[model samples]
Target: MRLNNKVIIVTGSCTGIGKAIALRCVAEGASVVVHGLEQDLGEAVINEIEKDKGVLQIEEITNEGAPERLVELAVKTFGKLDAVVNNAAMILSSNMETTDLAFLRKVLDVNTVAPFALIKAAFPYLAKEGGCVLNIGSVNAWSGEPNLFAYSVSKGALMTMTRNLGDTLFRESGVRVNQINPGWVLTETEIQRKRSQGLKDDWYKDISSVYAPAGRILWPSEIAAAAIYWLANESGPISGQVVDLEQYPLIGRNPPKN
Candidate 1:
C-alpha cells in the first residue's frame, strides 16, 4: 500500500468529494479521520471504512475550534498525524451586488478561514512527520462566475493560502502543501438538483457541449484519485501547485470547444 501506516484527516468527508478521498485513503492503508457536520453521514462513512477493515475515526467539525479538535483527536487516537486534506467548504449562489454581508462572512469563514486554521493547527504534527496538506479548491477560483461570487473568492484565497503555506513549510519545515481545484462535479446533490429543476438527460449533453472538454462532468472518484496520489506518493517536490480537476488541457481554460 502506498500510504502504509500513514495517518490522515479529511474534513467535510461525510459526502461528495471529501467522502471519496477518505475512502481512497483508507484503501491505500492509511488510518483515516473523517470530519463533517452530519453525524449520521459521518458515521456511515466510518462504517463503510470499517467494513473494509480500515482503521478510521469520526468528528463533527464546526466553527468552534474544529480544526484544533480534529488534529487533537487524530493525535489522541492514532498517535500521530501524517496528512490532512482540507476539503470542507460551502457553495452558495450569490453575486457581489446581491450577496449579503452575513452570507459573505459565512462563506469566507467556512471556506477560507477554516482551512487556514486547520493547517496552522496541524502544522506541528505535519512538520514532525514531514507530512503534506492538500486543500480542495475550485475552478471558480480562476474563472469569473456570476452567481458564485463568495465561493469563488474563498477558493481563490485558498489557492493563495496553499502557495503561501507550501513556501513557508518548504523553507522552514519539511511539510508540503498543495491545492486541488475541481470543476463541476456530478455529486448526488447536483444530480438531484438538476432533476428537481426538470433537467433531463439532455441537460448533461448540454453541459458537456458547453463546458467539459472531455464531454462529461467530473466524477468524485477522479478527484479522489488525485488526492490519493498527493498524499501517498513521495511527490513532495511538486508541492504548492494547484491540481485542476477539470478535463481542460490548459490552466484557466473554460468553455470547451465544440
Candidate 2:
C-alpha cells in the first residue's frame, strides 16, 4: 500500500510499461488515470483495476488540449491529482538517410512535446499536493542505436526537460520531477518487432549476455517498481534526476565479442 489514497495519471497505460505502472499503482491503493491511445487495451486495463477497489480512468492523449482534458478527467473522477507518468511514446525506426524533418517533428510531438504539455496541465493539481512527475525515458537517451535516431533525439530532449522542470517546479511550486531511462525492456511491442525482423519465436534467447547481464532484459513491472518509488511520498525532497535502468553502463558501452 505504498501509494494508498494517492492519485496518478499514467499516459500510454493501455499497454507495456504504462499499463504495468497503472496496475501496480492500483494494487498499492491508488486511484489511477490510465491514459492511452487504444480503446480495447484501455478497457482491459480498467477492468483489471476495478477488481481491486481502484478508481481507474481511461482516456486518450493525442489531440488539442489533451493534457488539460486528461488532468480534468482525473480531478473530476478522483477529486484531485498527485502525480503524472509521461509514458506515451512512439518508437519508429529511422536512420540518417531516412530521418526527415516531418518524421523528426512527428516524433518530437509525441515523445517530447506531449510530455511537456501534460506536465504543464497537471502542475496546478500536483503543486497543491506536492506531487511529482516521472517520465519514462530510455537508455536511447544516451544517443541510441542508429536505427532509433529520431527516438533517441526525442528522448534526449525529454531528459533535459525533466531536469529543467524538476528544478523550476521545485523552486517555484514544490513539485518534484524525475526521469527513468529504462534499457531494453521486453514489452509486447518489442516481441512483435523482433519477430517482424525475422527473429525466431524464442528470440528471447538471442539477447547477448553482455547486453542482458541479468540474463534477460527488463520487464514492465520492474520499471513500474521504480515509478512507484519516485511517485510515493517517501522519496521526499529529491528532484531533477535521470536514472539509468540498464544492465550495462550506457556511456561508451560496446557489444561483447561473440
Candidate 3:
C-alpha cells in the first residue's frame, strides 16, 4: 500500500493507459478521480474502482477550465490531493504537407495545453501535500516520425513542460514533477483495431519482433507500474526525470541481456 490514503487524479482514465493507471492507483490504496470525455467509459472505470472498495470519482474534462474543476472535485471529495497524472492525449497522423491548421490546434489543445492547464490547476493542491505530477509523454518526443508530426510536437512540449514545472516546483512549491514515455503499448482497443485492419497473428508477431525491439509489445499495466513507482511517497528524491518504459536502450545501443 505505497499510496495508502492518498488522492490521485488521472486524466483520460476511460480507456488505454490512463484507465490502467487509475486501476493501479486504486489497487495501491489511493482514492482515484477518473477524468475523461466519455461518460459511459468513465462511469465504467469508476464502477470497477468502487467494486474494489476504493473511493472513486468521475469527471468530464473536455470543456474549458475543466482541469481546474477536476482538481476542485478531488479536494472536495477526498479532502486532499497527493498526485496528478496527466495521462490524457490524442494521436493524429498527418505529415506537415497535408496537415491542417485546425487539426494541429485540436491535437495540441488536448495533448499539450490540457496537461499544462491541469498541472497549473493541480500545483497548489499538490504543493500543499508535497505530492507529484506525472506527465505522459511519448518516445516520439525524442525521435521524429513523418506522419505523427503534431503528436510528436505536442509530446515534445510536454517534456519541456515537465522539466520547467519540476524546476519551478522544486524552488517554489516543493512539488515533484516527472514524465513517463511509453512505447507501443497494445491496449485492448488497439489490438482489436489492428485485427479489424486485417492484421493477422503473424503480423503482430513480426511487429513485436521488428518494431518494439523488446520481442513483445507492452501492456498498459506495465506502464502503470512505472507511474505507481513515481507517485509513491518513497520516490521523493527522484524528480525531474523522464522515464522511458519502452525497453529500448537510451543511447540507441542495445545492451547484452543479463
Candidate 4:
C-alpha cells in the first residue's frame, strides 16, 4: 500500500474524477474524507468504501468556513490530515460577453479561491507530516476555448498559485504543492454537460482526432492513477510542478484535415 496509514481529503468526491481518486486512495490504504454538495451521492461513495475507511462531508467549496469544516472533519475523523486533493471546481461555459464581473467572481470563488482556502486550513497538519497538495487543474489554463472565458481564467490563476505555493510551502514547511492539468475527461458531469448543450447521447463515442487522439477522452481512473504518485511519498523532494495529462501536445499541434 503506497499510502498506508495516510489520511487524505478529497473535495468534490461524490462524483467523477474526485470519486475515482477517493476510491483509489482507500484501496491504497489511506482513509479518506470524501466531500461534495450532493448528500446521496456522497453517501453512495461512502457505501462503496468500507465504513471505516471513508467518511463524507457535504458543503459548497466556496461557502464561508467550508474549508475549515472540511479540515476539521478530516482531523476529527482520522486524527490528522496527510494530503488535500483540491478537486472541486465550477466549470461554466461563457464567452467574454456573457462573463460579467459577478460571473467571473463566482467562477473564481469555487475554482481558485476555495482551493487556496482549503490549503491554508490544512497547512498546519500537512506541515506536521510532510504532506502534499494536489490541485486538479485543466489544460484550459493555457488561454482555453473561447467559450470558457471565466473558467479558463480561474484555472490560469490556480496554476500560478500552484507554482508560487509549491515552492514557498515546500521550502517553508516541507509540504509539497503540485497540480495536474487533465485534458478532456469523460466524467458524469461532462456527460450531462454535453447533453445539456444539445449533443447526442453518445457524443463522446465519436470524438474527432483533434480532441481525442486515442479515439476517446481520458478516464477519471486514469487521472486518479496519476494522482497517487504526487500524493505518495514516492514523489520525493518534488514540488511546484504542473503536469499536463493529455493525449497530444496542448500547444501548436495541427490536426489532420482529413
Candidate 5:
C-alpha cells in the first residue's frame, strides 16, 4: 500500500498507458479520478477498480474549463488531491508537406497547453497536500522521426514545462513535478495504427532488436511501475528529472540495420 490514503487524478485513463497507471495507483491504495474521452472505455477501466477506489469522468482535455472542472471533481469526490498524472495526449504522423500550421497548433494545444492548464488548476490543492505532478512524455521529444513533426514539437515543450515547474514548485510549495519519456510502447492504439500502415497482425512478435532490445517493445505496466515510484513520497525531495525509458541511449545511436 505505497500510496495508501492518497488521492490521484489520471487523465486519458480509458486505455493504454494511462489506464495502466490508474489501475496501478488503485492497487497501491490510492483513490483515483479517471478521466477520458471515451465513455465506455472509461467505464471499462472503472469496472476493474476496487469498490469506492475510482470514479470515472468523461472529458476532452482541450475543452474550455475542463482542467478546472477536473481538479474540482477530484477534490469534491475524494475530499482533496495528492497527485496528478498528465497522461492524455494526441499523436499524429505527418511530415512538413502534409502538416499544416493549424493542425500543429491543435497538437500543441492538446499535448502541451492541456497539461499546463491542469497543473495550474491543481496547484492550490497540490500545494496544500504536498503532492506530485507526473507528466507522460515521449523519447521523441528528443527529436522524433521526421514524420512525427508536430507531435515531437509538442512533447518537447512538455519536457521543458516539466523541468521549469519541477525546479520551481518543489522548492516553493513542496509539490514535485517530473516526467517520463517512454519509447515504443505496445498499446492498443499503436497496434491499430501500425496495422493501418500495413504491418501484419503479429507485428509485435517480429519486432526488430533495434526498436525493442529486450526482444519486445515496452509494456504500459512497465512505465506505470516507474511512475509510481516517482509519485510516491518515499522517493523524497527529488524533482525535475526526465527519465528516458528506452533500449538504447536516445542520442548518437547508430541507424538501425533494416
Candidate 6:
C-alpha cells in the first residue's frame, strides 16, 4: 500500500533486478510498465503480475525514441507516471588493453545515455505527481575491477548524473532522484554470466568469504525492498543520495587471506 495508485516504468525488467522491482511495485498497489529486450520474458512478467497492474514493452533501451515510447506506455496504460527505475544496462568485461572506442561507446550508450533519455522523457509526468527516479547502479562506480573498465566508467557517469539531477530536479520540478549501488547480487543474469566465464554451475554456492561475508550474495528481492523506499512517498525531500547495498565494506576494508 506504500505506492497506492502509482504508475512506474521499469526498464530491462524482463529478468533479474528489474523484474523483481516491477513485481514488488505491483504488490505495493502500483501499476507498472514492464520492459526488456525479450518479448517472451516481458510477457511472462506481465502475466505474473495482476492482470490490471502491468503492461509489457519489448525494445532495446538505446534504440531511437525507445525512451519516449516507454513513458508513453505508462501514461497510456496506467494513466500517469509516478516513478522510473532505470535498470537496463550492458555488463561487459574489458581491460584497458582490450577496450576500444566502439566498445566503450556501446557500454555508455546503454548504461549511461539510455537512462538519461528515459528520465528526460518521464520528467513532465514525474513532476506532475512529485514522482521519483531510482537508478540501479553498481558498487563498481567507485574503482571497479580491472576487467570491468568500460562498465565501471559508465556506472560512474550514471552516479554523477543521479546526484546532479537529484539536486536540480528536486529543486526545479519536485521529482526526487536517487541511486542504489548494489554489490554482488545473485540475479538470474549473474548466474548465467558466471557460468559463461567458465565457472562451474554451482560457483555461487561457495563464494569466498571476503566477497560474501554473509555466506551468500544479495538477492534481487532484497534490492527491490530497498527500492520501494525511494519510489514511495516515504522518501520525502531526500534527493541526491547514493546508497551502497553490499555485504562487506566497499571501501577501506582489508580482507583476511584465504
Q: What is the TM-score of each predicted model, taking all chains together?
A: 0.90, 0.95, 0.89, 0.99, 0.98, 0.99
- Ten consecutive residues with minimal summed lDDT in candidate 6? 249-258
lDDT of 1: 0.83
Residue-by-residue lDDT tens digits, candidate 5, 1-258: 999999999999999999999999999999999999999999999999999999988979999999999999898888999999999999889889989999999999999999999999999999999999999999999999898999999999999999999999988999999999999999999999899989998899997788778999999999999899988989798899899988888899886767
TM-score of 6: 0.99
- Candidate 5's TM-score reads 0.98
Clashes of 3: 0
Q: Please give, for residues 147-199, the per-residue lDDT of candidate 2 as tens digits.
A: 99999999999999999999999999999999999999989888888888899
Best by lDDT: 4
Q: Ten-residue segment with the worst summed lDDT in candidate 3?
A: 52-61
Clashes of 1: 0
Which residue pairs in model 6 clash with each other? none
Locate the minimum summed-lDDT window of 10 residues in model 2.
Answer: 52-61
Better of 2 and 5 by lDDT: 5
RMSD of 5: 1.0
How close to the true structure is residue 89 of candidate 3, measured as C-alpha lDDT?
Answer: 83
In order of lDDT, best first, we have 4, 6, 5, 2, 1, 3
Better model by TM-score, 2 or 4? 4
lDDT of 4 by residue, 1-258 (tens): 999999999999999999999999999999999999999999999999977999899989898999999999999998999999999998879998998999999999999999999999999999999999999999999989899899999999999999999999999999999999999999999999999999999999999987887999999999999999999999999999999999999888878787
Q: What 10-residue stretch in candidate 1 is worst by lDDT? A: 52-61
lDDT of 3 by residue, 1-258 (tens): 988989998988889999999999989989988877677887778788856333344554557778888888888888999889998887756689877898888888888898888888988888899999999998888865687899898899889989888887877878899999987788766677577668884555665344667677888999998889899988866778897777675456555554
Model 2 lDDT at residue 147:
95
